[model samples]
Target chain A: MWSGWADIMDPHSLTKLNQCRRERRAAILLTDLGDGSDRVIVEGDAVDGALGDAVANAFRSGKSGTREVDGRAFFLNVHLPPPRLVMIGAVHISQALAPMAAIAGFDLQIIDPRTAFASPERFPNVRLDAEWPEDVLAREPLDAYCALAALTHDPKIDDPALTAALKADCFYIGALGSRKTHARRVERLTAAEISSASIGRIRAPIGLAIGAASPAEIAVAVLAEIIEALRSRGVGAERGKAA
Target chain B: MSQTMQSAPPKDPLTIAEEWLKDGKEVAIATVIETWGSAPRPIGSHLVINKDGLFEGSVSGGCVEGAVVTEAADVIADGKPRLLEFGVADETAWEVGLSCGGRIKVYVERLG
Candidate 1:
């Protein structure tokens, strides 16, 4: 009987049988082998086999998988958003503000032409650039997640940055100055052809009027204002409350 | 381009909580939910506690951690959330060395 069984199962037939066994373990089956002229026939329980095939295809294509288990198809998708920030100064306020912003989920960068002010030691954890504002900002594209703040209080340092920030449509643009300083700066910017609406976008006297006197206190106020600005833009309340 | 992609390590409390969570441990998070005048930690400062009663953050200086950590351990073990409060009235405010006569309320939650 064994000899007869062996004779019935030839090498080609044995190979096909083994393949079928493997497919069955995987909840699928190959019903027919394809020749050059005909396609392969694969038949299995549609619920598991077809669904699994769809999921595999989706995974291979880097897309959300859709599979009907009973009568419902479940879709799975994953999205990871990008990070952004724009600091238009390398002053003490920037030193304090950058790390605080990072704690609240911002990617901070400091831009200034004063090499002495912008250094690894001064901004130990932030990115620093010792370049002219317009030259540096022009190369980086701004988006909704981006925030721009000028803390230098010097027109040479702040004006070019304000121009770039206004042009790029950054979500937040704040400049650190007193009321008198802001009035003078606005005049200069208006003369430079910045629109009133764009000028209005700046939050000069850039804080919540918390009577902040120290560098750390001023840092807190600036971060608070930035959070409020971000909240108004609809990012959400939790982010605003983080710092 | 480089100016847009730099950031620092998170605040100590947040960083500690994240590290603990990533390590697959249940953590208890405590926050200074409310405060009056002259509290050391202020509102929103945090303290995180692990299952073993080990803590990685501070809600206040030496004055309040002992009580807060005890409460935190209870929270971690029982998985029940609770709010703890510490305060001083105007008369005894100087006892705890809280110079600014006021009160403070801390909210403690168990986070797995």
Candidate 2:
């Protein structure tokens, strides 16, 4: 609980901050106007990365906030990475989801092992992980800002990704399927040892029941549901870096 | 190099500075670090400007963007960062910050 101004605007801190955003790391930049001491911290890292106790709460809440340390006021600007949408299918629906989600401000990644389906000609201008869904999730490891959508009705592709999403606890976990298909999915997942609670996290028959029939309409419904979940959180309440 | 591997466009305002820096251009970024009342843009919104007066994004919708861009050029040349404040000082200048009846504080910083 202290503060001071000690040349906080040095180029080093700003450079490191840019790296944090580039890497999509949740970070907080603490600026102490008292003596001008600036400190930066990336999530999962100690505030030691920050200059001092200026950022008392390394786990500070909210996108950003201001605090008074001693008599000096400190402005904490939290920069979370853009929300990531990881679609575990390169199906017709995904083509629509990709551009739509991008327009809504999500960083996109499509994961599918089916080479012909995952072809860039289909995904054009989208991030594609031709590797299996589990492998991509294992390598990338979804964060809170990530939303996982398993559109392939195939268990091999969708289940592993759904398992990964549940484990990662991403804010939104959606899977495309009819009720009958979803019931079978639940049994398969239960046999795979995924908890009912975790499986419950998925929004089955994913997307708002807009009675969507076409792939593009279904895409709109799904993207809308994702946005609803992302926005419905105390999320983006203020100056969150959600977008 | 497949299109799937093509990089997505930068979505964060902070990326502008990093991109312009790597492109070997003198750049300045004006960010809406704070706002009061009906400010147009939320905090962290940015307007990236180069020495050429070209800028991207918005800090105040249309109200104070021109002023911020003009000052960004000075920041680029002077290598100094400055805070800009804009809003209606009175009933007459309500056009200054627009009818939003709010004020915004933008921080303009020069980046290499």
Candidate 3:
């Protein structure tokens, strides 16, 4: 019921930004406060000067703010893909984790080959994949935005996903096992030709040293650990913030 | 995965704005450009409105949406953008101030 305005934001830019969001790609909407002009900058886009530095920082921190660049004010509205929690097993710990992770804004998914464990009745309202990690992850690969947790305690089911997560450099990679169990896992993974440095990234004895006994308690510990990884991402040495 | 990510909610203000524009409706987007102290909403939050007063999303908890909606009408009528401030310092605090005592600067402009 109206003619378009001459100075309105280009509809093309809005659509592009939304497309980036749907693609789980990072984007920044840069708007000049003085002129009300705007454009969308996808991650890895080459932007120059102080503004470019600001844009890069926003992409890393996922924080939105107004920056003063070259005497002009620009608002950088950043949209990073939501973090994904991909559980390698639909065990009891995952049952507790599924709901808790959702409350914390994670896109939680459970992948298990055993239909008996990944049944809809067990994981209602969660993304349950009653398929092998190899097949599911092949279709939807892991990314730095994803956190992979191997919980089945079975080498056949957990080892392959752990290998994939490490290869993909997932922000958080965890495997559930005792120290002895993890040692054997390390040996097997080492024999598989995965570099020790890459294998070292896996959080074994998974979760924090919270002395968690119950599955729900362990879920809390694991979620906290994932948050720690997510927050301290990109800064290699600052991971000592939490025990 | 990029190929399989679900769509954004139908009620998301920006999505609604794009849909409304595609439907040939006049739309205005209000964005919180800055916030101070205990602002209810963070910077970059959006509130979108159509010329018919239909709106979605919120720039504030619920305190200043009415004023933003009113200003959006003017933005839709004219192509000029509007920068609005609401806080304890403004003289119109009694009328449209944020009850949380925080300050926010919102930029509203028409969407083509």
Candidate 4:
């Protein structure tokens, strides 16, 4: 089967696939359609294609699956950027969180307006955005690939970051704080018009309750909780249930 | 002049294939189209091979790389795409130490 010849994927589809990769847009590649055919479909445009629904669904799960279109089977390969963890504070916890997240196959970035907290000296080799959460989030925006965490205990910083994350519909929204502090934060967010359902989405006291004592332990807890939310879709969708 | 250092990001499979083609390498790309059971790698994982046996990336973790490379050599020469399959039934799995290895379906195609 390896010695026959033909370029089944048209140049037009090939160009679209390349463009999607360059833009970091999710795309589904459908190949091996019996006639040695291949087609790369980008999101939003897939539904118009022959295997549109399969492409759209595979895009969400980020995995490859086979579908039988008529008697012939086709494989849909989903491709998207690596998952990203956007840290809202450059705290001691974040210092530990960044490298661990990278090791877990997540692209990590620290966002803080305070220059002292976000300096390159402190966060060497990490993506540091030295702008207020609201401003930076507004400019760059967040997508499904992102997991946003607010590590700063300060309301002035963490609250706005959570608010932005909710709007972006981040898969995971974690806030580092005590239960008492989260209650106060909730009150403020309620006052700011963030819905109860949205507030519930925040993984308060962030991280799994592993009886963490120090910043490093807390970082471990946080990363663990984030993974739970990521791997367990039900856990991540807890906010939707609040409605 | 002191130059600043920046960390380069990982390139996607298409970009790697394009680069290989640009470098005047005769390339055939093997992509994991479908998998059953414990697929160590996700779908869309790619292995690009040149006529000279040089390869980049992987389709399966390691179970069928040698077979894919040998097939890819024919693909590069014949210009015909082949859909290849490897499973636990294949003796290569025992050699690769994959425990009752899963079935992996890869599509090997020539990319110009």
Every candidate's DockQ is 0.06, 0.17, 0.40, 0.28
- DockQ versus reference, model 3: 0.40
10 residues in a row with least lDDT, candidate 3 chain A: A1-10
TM-score of 3: 0.82
Candidate 4 matches the true fold with a TM-score of 0.71
Q: What share of the true interface contacts does each candidate keep?
A: 0.15, 0.13, 0.59, 0.35
Model 3 DockQ class: acceptable
Sort all candidates by DockQ, best to worst: 3, 4, 2, 1
| Candidate lDDT (C-alpha), each | 0.62, 0.75, 0.88, 0.77
- Quote the lDDT for A71 in model 4: 66
Q: Write the per-residue lDDT of candidate 1 for residues B9-109, one digit (tens) a residue.
A: 34466456656666877677676656667778755466877777778677776566767788888777775556666666534334544444556666665
TM-score of A-chain in each prediction? 0.63, 0.75, 0.85, 0.80
lDDT of 4 by residue, A206-240 (tens): 88989999989988998998877666543333356
Q: Name model 3 segments beyond 4 Å from true.
A: A1-7, A119-125, A167-169, A183-200, A209-217, A237-243, B1-8, B89-93
Any runs in candidate 4 off by more than 4 Å, and if so which? Answer: A1-7, A41-61, A65-72, A233-243, B1-6, B16-28, B34-43, B48-80, B85-105, B110-112
The order by descending TM-score is 3, 4, 2, 1
The interface root-mean-square deviation of each model, in the order shown, is 23.0, 4.7, 5.3, 4.7
Please, what's the RMSD in Å of model 1? Answer: 20.6
Q: Candidate 1 residues A92-179, lDDT tens each?
A: 8787788888898877788888988887778886788888888877776555456788888889988988888788766678888889
Worst 10 residues of 4 chain A by lDDT: A1-10
Model 2 CA deviation exceeding 4 Å by range: A3-7, A10-16, A30-76, A234-243, B1-4, B8-31, B35-42, B45-82, B86-104, B108-112
lDDT of 2 by residue, A1-243 (tens): 334234325455667898887676777776654444666766655444233344434333335545665566666777777788999888999998999999998989998899988888898788888889877777668877799999989998898888888877787999999999999999999999988988887998999999999999999999999888876643333245335
Which candidate gets the maximum lDDT versus the true structure?
Answer: 3
Q: Each model's TM-score, in the order given?
A: 0.46, 0.65, 0.82, 0.71
Estimate how well candidate 1 is docked, as a DockQ score: 0.06
What does the lDDT read for residue A87 in candidate 1?
82
Predictions ranked by lDDT, top down?
A: 3, 4, 2, 1
DockQ (0 to 1) for model 2: 0.17
